[model samples]
Target: MRDLVAAFGGELPGCDTPGLLGWLDAFSDEHWNFRGRLGGAERDRVRVELPPRLAAAGLAAAAALGLAGSGEPAHREYTHLLILGGLARSCLQRADHAARLAGALRVGGIAALGSLRPLSAEERALPGLGRCRTEADALAAGVRAAFGGRAVPVLVAPPGDPAAHRANTADTYEFWAAGAHPGPGDRILVVTSPIYVPFQHCDAIRILGLRYRCGIDTVGFDPRLAHPPQPGGAAAADRCLQEIRSAIRAARALLAAVG
Candidate 1:
């Protein structure tokens, strides 16, 4: 895999973030962080088959396993910009969907953002922010800045818990969405790291979609797992590996059922 990735553009591959960065070091493109997004036609196929399989999985998504790797709150935002900028733009090309997103943003559209941890100094200093500290601040600021008079994004973290974990944020979005959105046609775009997307979708559909009459679309923050190890332990690395593995198992099962 490393050799293939490095050979993609004739760059050297190490592992994880290093490999991605090494490729980028020799890479040139319109997009600096061009890690490809996951869960498209293939994901859709699995999704179509997944609902039926859920009953058998016992809701643990034991049906799905093998997935992980997301950076700090700020890193997530950075990744999101690379992925959604391209994706949302493509969806906008469709006049009907574009109009829907615009109208929804103005009235019924809700961009429900998951909670984030505190921003790093580097994150704060990133091109357009002033002094963003918390994940909510960064996301809220980012949403407003990006959509600008188009839509208002909300931080759906549980009260008193600004830094909710992945599992918790999955559920919180549904709660907030239920309140902020009521129109049957209301549109929701859930934003998070790519790895967390599947889990987020399952949680949202099971909780929010089942209860509310609305449309939901998700985009990964970024496609590459490029975050290097933190100071001490390999906890983050382990988690990312686990998540990848989990997503694969589930995705494979779902796809298999389709076949």
Candidate 2:
């Protein structure tokens, strides 16, 4: 947290003010589990503050990603990052806002995403579903046209529900079937829950660790556990943090190679 604050090279909002970190820390301590640790009230606190913090950090990290690789300082005011959760509406909403900010980038600019899964056409049809689907599709299409190819090289991993996941996977397959190659510099990452693997053909897990040169780490917490619970939750969070760091490093390497 302190490192994040220092990265901004300025005071963080509510950082020095009394009870801010204390409140956030308290919330984290309370709701760190999944079963029943966090009740309605504590959950509300996380829903409110966590989004903004993640968005801010994601944007900054993305800019840093670009800068470290291309030496072209990111000029955009915002970065696009996506976050998707199995049943978390708040996470999706925050992701929607972040995607909007990222779309403001100029041509050749980067769109850094942190998503549970790529948006489906069904989700796109919903009112106010946001730009993840739209922008991603557009970018893919643009890359294809530029390369003059009949299809793009995409790897899909469908959801757990065989039928629904298959449908979604098929839709993406069809899209890519008609898409052109996305040039060397263009890239996309679609992250999903451990259980969801819609596309049976693609080794999504392997792609994360080897192909895209990155992987996601997750830590599960049961909310029913006691406050400041045993070592389980922290261990998970640590694993997640480590995996995220590894992914950042991998992404940086990819960007550098392209540059």
Candidate 3:
């Protein structure tokens, strides 16, 4: 963890877990959250040109933190399987992973949650989702393609402020939890890309797990196992850095909520 902190120009404070999370979040927000504005640009869409040493450090840190997919959940049964939405290709990849897990695990139901953010022209033209217009639509289409006619619930949340930003992970999780109302004994498994697992997992814990008193386990789609094969390069390292910043912020939120 300390190595990861140093990799991103952060210093791990000598403190308990909560204090460390707060420090990391503060540092990340000040130094690493690089988006121009709320929805004006996205973390993944940002083009990065990192120094070779920095890129290598970022990738190593990500792997140490399990941001490079664990490939399996901790348990074989879950009351709900939630696939978090993202970029067009990521939506399909994560949905495919979720479907594979659902087949082998005892899952009660499945839900793909996304925001109402409008899809870009490039995203709309993606295969298997040519007719889709929004992130939610992409996720729903992915589920359809991966599950092969299986009926799965798709939830979409309007942006908190349409003029500023798109609906985020918290909004989607809140929307689903409020509707599904999982019990204390139930467990939910969340699926997304490896880079996003840390932050999204923390978000799920803050919203669904804490509020509904249900267990939440978040995992990522293994890039090595992806059907079309996820491309690799320095860009992946940059994305991991972005998501590590995201995780720092979300961890702070989770700690505050726990308090």
Best by TM-score: 3
User: Measured by TM-score, how close is model 1 to the native structure?
Assistant: 0.42
lDDT (0 to 1) per candidate: 0.38, 0.31, 0.81
Screening candidate 3 with a backbone cut-off below 3 angstroms (N, C-alpha, C), the clashing residue pairs are none
Evaluate residue 3 in candidate 2 and report its C-alpha lDDT on the 0 to 100 scale.
Answer: 41
Better of 1 and 2 by lDDT: 1
Each prediction's number of clashing residue pairs: 21, 20, 0
Model 3 lDDT tens row, 22-60: 777777666556564344376556666778877788788
Candidate 1 per-residue C-alpha lDDT over 1-259 given as tens digits, one digit per residue, 9 for 90 to 100 = 2332232334444566544533433442211112222222211112112233322332232223312333222111111111121112111122122222343343333453444444556446644445655555655555555465755545445544445332144346545655565446545555444445564555555545556755555544322332211222222322233333333333333333334
The Cα error of candidate 1 at residue 13, in Å, is 34
TM-score for each candidate, following the candidate numbering = 0.42, 0.24, 0.90
Q: Which scores better on TM-score, 1 or 3? A: 3
Q: Cα lDDT for residue 87, model 1?
A: 16
lDDT top scorer: 3
